[model samples]
Target: MFLRLSPRHGSRLLTRIYSAVAARRCPSCSAPLPTALPTCPSCSHIEPLPSTLSYHDIFGLPSVPNPFCVNTQTLKARFLQAQKICHPDAWSGKGKKEHDIAAAQSALLNKAYQTLLSPLQRANYILAQQGLSESETDRLGDTELIMEVMEAREELEEATSGEAVELARQRNRDRINRTQKILEKLIGERRWDDAKKAAVELKYWETIENAVKDLE
Candidate 1:
């Protein structure tokens, strides 16, 4: 008989394997890390760790968010491991300075995790990391895309019946999905201007989605 694993079980197994593989060692004694434990298991040296690493460095991921590939299982595994190491509560027994550092590192890790988890946020983060801002994003000059957004908003506003509203919502969902694909391609190609435009379009669609949800 063959054993079968469900998707959830498979993801959990992958996460554990990835976490174990990506675990960081103590700088002092080089003991294998189980989580982001504050002290070296072998040397018992209490030192601030993981605070010095960047978000991508902490996760063992590439510096840039890869548009073509994202392993959420790996990301989650890394996040959990980092949290274990950096959560302020984990450092409470140490010193005030160490506790404060842990708190700050935890905050940064949370921000990075949330940003990378959502496609829209991930795109915006990538653009922002490349020095693109909302004001800069508006200058993409895609008149047709702008017009389509305006038309969609108009249609949503004019929609009255339940069926009409549902139809409008579905249309907006389709537009959102299409724009997301464009955004991914633009980001993958390092086209900042076009990606920013796509990101802005996504924001509009998200607003429309919220409004439709409110109506329902």
Candidate 2:
């Protein structure tokens, strides 16, 4: 007979398995790293273990296409922790190689945080990870979407009053929301072609939104 474990027990089992499979150790002093801590306690080393960890891994997020459900508070906290560890100033007394590594890691962490912070950017990052290219994304062939964006821009350009402009802005925001849902569905299905097209269409709507803001 198979025994089902409780949630707490399952979580503990997963943690133990992860620890055994991918435990991090300090490169400086070869000490095991505590959860989410940046430095080695034994040697006071400020650098993290050297590994090709993805952005999701760096942020302790699930490796999924839609990171929209990520908690903003948790993301901010993790980003601050990582920055504190990888900041160049923290490595001032270290050697040149270590300092350089710290700077590079800090830059990467910043990029990851910024990318995942914005829904559109996170979608684009997911597409890129799936081997989609800018040129492919730019070559959007959805005639209906193209016409809709054109009409929206024309509406924005012809608006004469603040109310009209606000209405246009609201319409664009609605379009963004709709397109984001489509993108999310496509990504969930691993439909890279359709997802890229949706992402490009969303970019156009975003540009329209910004233009409306300028008019306001």
In the order shown, the candidates' Cα RMSDs to the true structure are 10.8, 6.9
Candidate 1 is scored at a TM of 0.71
Write candidate 2's Cα lDDT for 1-216 as tens digits: 987999766765655444344446765777876534345546757544334455666767765555445666888888897787678898878888778877887888898899888777888888887798556338558787678888999999999999999999998999999988888788888888888888888888988988977765
User: Can you write out model 1's per-residue Cα lDDT over 142-173, one digit (the tens) per residue?
Assistant: 68877887888899899989999999999999
Off by over 4 Å in 1: 1-23, 34-54, 63-68, 136-140, 161-163
Worst 10 residues of 2 by lDDT: 14-23
Candidate 1: global Cα-lDDT?
0.70
Q: Model 2, stretches more than 4 Å misplaced?
A: 1-42, 46-51, 65-69
- Cα deviation at 104, candidate 1, in Å, is 0.7
The true-structure Cα RMSD of candidate 1 reads 10.8
Model-by-model lDDT, in order?
0.70, 0.74
